[model samples]
Target chain A: MSDTRIIKKRYIFMASVFIGLALLLVILPEKSTSKQLKPEQLLLQINDNNRYVSTDEDARKIIAGDNYMQLIDVRSPGEYVEFHLKGAINIPIDSIFNKDKNGDYVYEDILNQDVKINVFYSNGTVYANQVWILLKRLNYKNNYVMKGGLNRWIETVIRPPKPSVTATVNEVALYNFRKAASMYFGGGSVAVPAEDNAPAPIIKKKPKQEEEGGC
Target chain B: MEEVKIQQNTPRKYMNPYLAGVLLGLVILFSFYLTREGLGASGAFKRGVAKVEQIIIPAHVNSEKSAFYHYVKNGEDPLKNRLVYMIIGVFIGGFLSGAINHRLKLKLEHSPKITSKTRAIAAVIGGAIFGIGSAFGRGCTSGAGLDGMAVLATSGFVVVGMIFGVGYLVAWFFRKLWI
Candidate 1:
């Protein structure tokens, strides 16, 4: 075949492939278009205030009390089964928008409750943040993320570090609260050794070099 | 024979690298805009492997014990994945690009210094190693390197740096194959 002829054939084949792709795109099921918040609005809401996010400390406080707070575990069921915060309802991230066997939206019942403060958490903040954003986009109120998720809970509440000798009264108080919280959460107290008894190391500041005059 | 000679002798014009780079950047940005995730290639290969494994050992592929079962356990078709579609689009795009430049040809590309057999063997080994590495890394060059870099992911920068660093380090020993 002539070079031009072969080129023409190839071009035709390429055109057909693109046309097929376009057809597929048109025919595929359209993604559910929920009334979502605009990017700018989301940014403003996420930044303007800490209303959309709850700290681990704040979450623990809520859990300790009889506050009407819904704790949603957004990790996989397997992970949820292994270990999760006490009283957290498991709802896999993938099934957040799915319907249950009874024809009701899986999360409709939980999300529709107006009184409870809905706080979502996962292994880390990423997935929880995603869920928070989605809920916020749908104009769902009282939605907050457990900041740093379970990871932060593990660090701050599960195994809180001891305050240094130079620590302020507030720091020591916070440490004590975390220690108590750890016990309440069933994370046995990590006996922080009395490192404060060690002698403070002497520090010598180096003499500052004279500044050179530039031309 | 005459057509073959003409085709071989005719050197095709290529797109400027900068222009190609800009176009690629635009595509990556668009992908990020549409989907929260970035482009990946190795995931598609993994899906393909999982699909084959499912056919041979349905029980093993379905079992929770297998590492691949995580991808298939949801009962979602592997081929229906976004990465699979993206890879298909990539193949078509590549063919169109090559065709437009008159660069499409039935031949194994290799350095002139190496025999075709040596090049083929090296290519297979390199690909196999890369496939294994990508699985561990959770993404390949385009996915982890380019997409990761675009998103300012630390893993993207680290992987790209390590890949090039190792490539440069080993290039000396493989000089005969290329130079």
Candidate 2:
């Protein structure tokens, strides 16, 4: 073929290839983890009790220093500064989607990963639930809302009402556990022995086998 | 047979710039899809420098005051990272592409107007300045220009504009080296 003919053929192929890639991108529309669920799918999960990690469980994780449990305080920065659960990382509700200085979504790796169960809490359920719904809609898994937020933590873990004399053995045992937790958190004087309780991991990881090594 | 001899004697024609650009865009898109990270070289180079510092002066890499300490802190090995592997792949791929095009050769490249020694010195100075600029910009051309633009990032567009804009604006001063 002539040089001009060869050049024309190459140009046409390049143009078509470029146009095809553009069309593919448009058609796919962010086929990544951008899995924005339909309202129906989201609604089905909104009422799912499993979305919540109870105050007791949250306290247990905190006390045990569970590596796989990441506590996120989803409140205003001022609220976070005033008080938050021990070891919680504060990501203000509004700034959850904002990227940090390094251009990564603020605490996004924790929100998106499965190795750790990200427990989000605020003053109440509203902010925490908002974060939960937002992350869930974006198809992020392994995130849970702390059922009653800081309010519940305060009520159950910080200052539990003493069990009545008629209370069951289990209720009495739970009260004693909370009493110990209150002391640990500097909210009570009674230094009761903490229960040897660690919340089970949300995700059951497969036992890691040793790698057979060779370069 | 005659055409084949001529082809062997000359470098192959370069790929069309538009086609190469589109391919690079696709590569960046796929990299994001698979790794959830941009394809950048400078960050990896930074990590490599951090590793070298650790090897040469272990104390310096561990010191909090040292800039490279960030990469080598807490017993973390930056050399074991994915970005480092990507850079290694880039070197091998570049060589392979050059060989395929019959452009593979080890020789000093200098403009006719400039001596080879001058070219070498200018390259070293230019590279050092570019390295400093990349550090300040948080990325080099490949990272900020191609990958950033691929994602429609504002920083990426700004970097690319600054690179060419500044290059053209200052080219007059460097014209003697080329012309």
Candidate 3:
């Protein structure tokens, strides 16, 4: 073959090969679908008002002892132990979706079950909302954020401002209900009764007493 | 000095540079897609060296004296990693390609002006310097430099540019080795 012919052939071959590679690169997602919700869908979910369970609703559910409702404190273990709802379970915001050795989510039963409604709360909605968004994005149903979190719950239930004397019947009824709940939760926010599901102190070592009579 | 011809008759059969580059680009992209991480040549080697040291002196692996404590800290196994396997795959793939192309040989490749022994000595010294440099730079040419370029990171451009710029400047002093 002549030099010109060989060189031309090589150029064409190179060009065609490159174009083929470019096409492959364009199609190179390799076909894997993420089950997580898209960003826009997640944003909409975040904005939706129905994702929140008001403190009143939360309180009513606890009062009724709804077997289907689960209160999840999305705070540090320390914070949860410091003060949380009467029957709240601690699931720190960071570890909500972590998996066990078997590759199943550690909180999968509590998080994704339709039989149980998981209501997450923190000192504020920030931590609860974070956990809620992540679980919601992962397509977990029956999960909700406790509106205004524990702070609002305390303001409304524990130290409820008495309704105005001219308040409507419904307002008076709500105040009475809150007053009843406040008393049920051990009156004025002393972290419920210590005997009522309060976790024992984690540091078990007794204080060492120096020798009383000897050096 | 006569102008050196880079291409000569019977130029060994090798894949086109452009083809190789495209393949490498695809590999890098796929690496990120699969691992959510970039291609890194030094990380595997670093782990390998650390693992070897751990096997030789188990106590030294985690002690302050060991330079590679980071790899084996908290009883972590440096060898049990995807990168180590990736490095092995790289070696096997390179060998297969070279064999298929009839480019597999035992001879050392060097400039015609230098003896094989001089080339060998220079390569060892140059590689040692580059190994130290990669540690300081946090990754080697393909990992930190090329991977950065693949993602259009400014750091990649800076690293590649500095490598070539310094190379050119030093090549003037070492021209006798080649020319």
Using lDDT as the measure, the top candidate is 2
Candidates arranged by TM-score, highest first = 2, 3, 1
Off by over 4 Å in 1: A1-215, B1-9
Q: Write the per-residue lDDT of candidate 3 for residues B52-97, one digit (tens) a residue.
A: 8888888887798876787788888987877777778889998987
The model with the greatest DockQ is: 2
iRMSD, all candidates = 21.3, 11.7, 24.3
For candidate 3, the per-residue lDDT at A169 reads: 100
What tens-digit string does per-residue lDDT give for candidate 1 at A1-215? Answer: 69889878877886787699879989999997666778889888877547545455554655576357767789998787677666667778898889778865657657644556677899888898888777777776677788788888778877888999999999998888888777767665333221223222222232233221000
**Clashing pairs in model 1?**
none
Candidate 3 lDDT tens digits, A1-215: 59989988988998998799889989898665548888899999888889899998888888898867788888998887677787778889888778899977777767776567788999989988888888888888888899999889999988888999899999999999999988877789556633446531222232333211000
**Candidate 3 residue runs with Cα over 4 Å from true position:** A1-215, B1-12, B64-67
lDDT of 1 by residue, B66-135 (tens): 6677667778676677888888988998999787667778998889988899999999999999988887
Per-residue CA lDDT of model 2 for B100-151, tens digit only, reads 7788888998889899999999999999999988886768888777777777
TM per candidate comes to 0.48, 0.60, 0.52
Candidate with more favorable, higher DockQ: 2 or 3: 2
Candidate 2, which segments miss by more than 4 Å at Cα? A1-52, A57-177, A180-215, B6-8
* lDDT for model 1: 0.74
Docking class of 2: incorrect
Better of 2 and 3 by lDDT: 2
Give the Å error, residue A206, model 3: 40
